[model samples]
Target: MYGHGYTQPVKPPPPAGLLVLLRVLFLGIAVFSIGFMAWAPLLRLAIVTRKSLDWGLFVAAMAADVLSIVLLGSEPGEDVRTAGGYLGITLLLGTLAVGSVYYLAADIRHFHQLRYPAYPVGQPRAAAYGYPQAPTPVPAPYTAPNPRQTPPPMPRTPAPQPPANTPPPRPPQRPAPARIDQVRAELDELSDYLRKHDEGGR
Candidate 1:
């Protein structure tokens, strides 16, 4: 009994050094394009007259494509057929590899359109921290309370004189006063001295 194993055709690895060489060639082609316009007038002519060059390249590429198709269908056991298929696949892969540059260019163009424009140069940006400062509020003018209206005074409770039998209230202790004559004389002397000094200054 045979175990179930999926039978999908395994694609062969790209021909030896084929992919690498094609990449180098494409890079050279791009470099040539830049130089054509910048350094070499003759190279620029080839690029400027690209319509004819494109058609020529397209025809060659298409021929390579047809060859590839024939090779893919051919029997590998037949030497000629196997060789043709290998050559076709090689050419087809190279053509696609070259065309990828155009795809990349178109992608760049599409991305450019999607991009947002830059903010105006030299214009200052708002701060990312605090909000804009608010204007100061002016204080209201002061108004005096109405003089005519007055609050009624609170009722005072008079203390009843203690019953005569109750012990007489002890008087609060008071410290002896400074000499009245001395204090009065000191005040008079200070006032007179100040007055004389003020008059002399004037």
Candidate 2:
């Protein structure tokens, strides 16, 4: 994940080297076939350099051609009287064997250049485009403070008092005494009412 305003570009994959692998495979197969299909390595190398031929591979293929020609022209066999006799065929096959090895090596080198490049390709894309920038504001010049006019003292805040954990115990008042006084007054009035009723009855 990217952090707040920054963006990261996706990573690109490296080269596969499939052409180099194919050339090697053909060379391996030609080895087992005893030079019967030696032209396969050349075909693979040609296809690999079709777009832009590498100087190394080009030189290797040219060398292989010249070596094969020299082997065919100079040797004579025990049975044949022609220029490329049985001994010549053997030497030509040996040249083909060598060609398979070097061609594979050259193709590997060419494909390697694709992955690990030689030139300077790391230039930034946005280096040339200049964006419009806001002009900076000029800072005001500083002035010394006057010593004659002293600055007013800052107001001090009162420190808060710590609250008491437990409150003082208040004197307990007897509510039952007041209630009994009220009942006594009501009982006197009730007795007087009973005496008046009795006199009225007599």
Candidate 3:
């Protein structure tokens, strides 16, 4: 009636092959890390993956932008300045500007991925339950009374206009207010009947 108690949908379990593939990948990375200068992240996911992932993307973006600006402001090298009246310099600046834009876009995308990675790559949970992924909040409202039930009766004249002439038509008395207890009972009965009917129809 209100809401079926809400639950977060979970992804399905991955195949056995996926687990083996991951294990092999980690083993390779560990061997490579040992061959290299003992990078902790490569050796163990615990070092790479934090309680909160920080890719330093924003800092990288800012550094790219600032470095581009600095290069432009500095004195140009003799070789670059002489190439077709600074055409080479122009291309250099353009490349830096484009790279800066790329970094900025990447940082923004990373921010969104951090906040709302609803279906992340490989679709694995923190527990490493590898799985592939991907709401209908629909409740109907009552419009009219159920067609199967008889409608409640309308108000009628109190006593069939008894002794009309003697009472001089009684000044056309006001309609009586509906009785709460009676209306409530009728509603309860109607609800129960309609519920049962709906269940049967289903």
* Candidate closest to the true structure, highest TM-score: 2
List the lowest-lDDT window of 10 residues for candidate 3: 34-43
Report each candidate's C-alpha RMSD, comma-separated, in the order given: 28.0, 20.1, 28.2
- Model-by-model lDDT, in order? 0.54, 0.64, 0.46
Residue-level lDDT tens digits of model 3 in 1-202: 5654667874443455664465455445434533121122222322323322233432343354345445445546534344343543353344334433443344345444554567543444444235443322345676887889998899887666566458554576654566767788899999999999999999
Q: Residue 187: error of model 3 in Å?
A: 67
By the TM-score metric, which is better: model 1 or model 2? 2
Reference-based lDDT, residue 167, model 1: 95
Residue 105, model 1, lDDT: 53
Candidate 3, position 183, lDDT:
81
Q: TM-scores for all candidates? A: 0.25, 0.35, 0.23
Q: List the residue pairs that clash in candidate 1.
A: 71-85
Looking at candidate 2, the ten consecutive residues that score lowest on lDDT are 120-129
Residue 94 local lDDT, model 1: 64
Q: Point out the higher-scoring one by lDDT: 1 or 3.
A: 1
| Model 2 misplaced regions, further than 4 Å | 1-24, 51-84, 120-202
Best-to-worst TM-score order? 2, 1, 3
